[model samples]
Target: MMTKLGPLLLVLLLAGPESSCGDNPRYEKFLRQHYDNPKSSFSGKYCDSIMAKRGLTKPECKEVNTFIHETKNNIKAVCEEGGEPYGNLRRSKEHMKVTTCKLKGGSTRPPCKYKENSSPRYIVIGCENGWPVHYDESQIVTTVDNADLD
Candidate 1:
């Protein structure tokens, strides 16, 4: 009985420390040291004075705020056509082709065109044209797999 009890006690002692590790004590300590613990930079001079007063650092607040702002921007851009924070225009999935577009006077690299992949494959559009106009089946949106797009 004594021998069996000794093994059980050792196992319990070893497992106890591992269970506490799941709390991410290392990460928590790091966060407290840099962002939350004593003399937090967010205090008084920053936007969230209460949090700051409680010892949140300026960098910590800034990181969280920036992440929120970026997430909002991404959501907006993914759904809408204009005023995206990243300034990338939303494009249609069809009715456009990648072709060499030439400038009226100067030479430009191959440009995207409003044309179908078959039957007169290339139809040039003005550089300032925002999006391609639909004319025929040839004017199909270039397909990209989600993984490739990413």
Candidate 2:
């Protein structure tokens, strides 16, 4: 079942300062564009619908983008607790579900095309004012020891 953003979720996403860790405009944008907690099921055309629904295809198709599937709180915990800081980017301590979107054949035209890859990997988020501002990167989680995955 595809969960469209609306109703109570809209209020939560568009909440005021009284909300929890995600209280800023950048955090809202990040949630709208990248964070998909109850994400859509993966398919060959996943990127096209998902990105359009998330508003990433608006001012021209984004070259590449990644969607993270995890609770907002868990994503924040990466920065607050076990995350390692590398300047403005912080790497998540746990491997997460993510789908990366890339432009197909280098096309930038309307009805933008994309290819997707879904896997377990560690993600990085840009932190600003203690909120996740944007997705920075994700590295494949090697099959090493759990504690040594980093």
Candidate 3:
């Protein structure tokens, strides 16, 4: 993470378009550096405020982004969950526990809206320093895996 522009571009090219989040280690590093939850409840308003504070509100707005409260080591271990592959990106089964988030309707401009949906499901994340730093949107396997534990 916090890699130079050249390395970032290289990683993006390898990750492809679908690998929106967690494609760039810099962004992952940014998330780890700025957004780690413990203070407030992980609610919709929390997503809105954090996204804006993290500079994810520029241009249009990030429609989807997940912030995991668990330790980075636990999150990174998800990659080895033996899930299927998603395009060229690495993915895990719908077993890893996570709190998912999406922007609510009418969230188009500044002061974006977000709705927090916490559940256990297959998640894709990028790792740095042997820790999962960013959640990848392209690699989400499923949301309907009710068997996932809370």
Best by TM-score: 2
lDDT top scorer: 2
Model 2 residue pairs with clashes:
none
The model with the greater lDDT, 1 or 2, is 2
- Order the candidates by TM-score, highest first — what do you get? 2, 3, 1
lDDT for position 67 in model 3:
59
lDDT of 1 by residue, 1-150 (tens): 999899999988987641332344443432232222122243333323433343433333321210011222222222344222112333332222222111122322222111111211222111122221121222223454376457
What is the C-alpha lDDT profile of model 2 across 1-150, one tens digit per residue? 236655667787787433475347888888788887777865658899888888888888988898888877777777678577745687777788888888887667677899888888878777876678878744444343465546
Report clash pairs, candidate 3. 94-122
After best superposition, candidate 2 residue 49: deviation in angstroms? 0.3
Candidate 2: stretches off by over 4 Å:
1-22, 42-44, 137-150
The CA lDDT of each predicted structure is 0.28, 0.76, 0.58
Range of the 10 consecutive residues with the lowest summed lDDT in candidate 3: 33-42
**Compared with the true structure, what per-residue lDDT tens digits does model 3 show for residues 47-134?**
7777776667778677877655544444455545553445434456545555555777765676678777666566665544434455
Model 3, runs deviating above 4 Å: 1-30, 33-44, 79-87, 126-134, 142-150
TM-score of model 1 vs. true structure: 0.16
- Per-residue lDDT for 40 in model 2? 85
Consecutive 10-residue window with the lowest summed lDDT within model 2? 137-146
What TM-score fits each model? 0.16, 0.74, 0.54
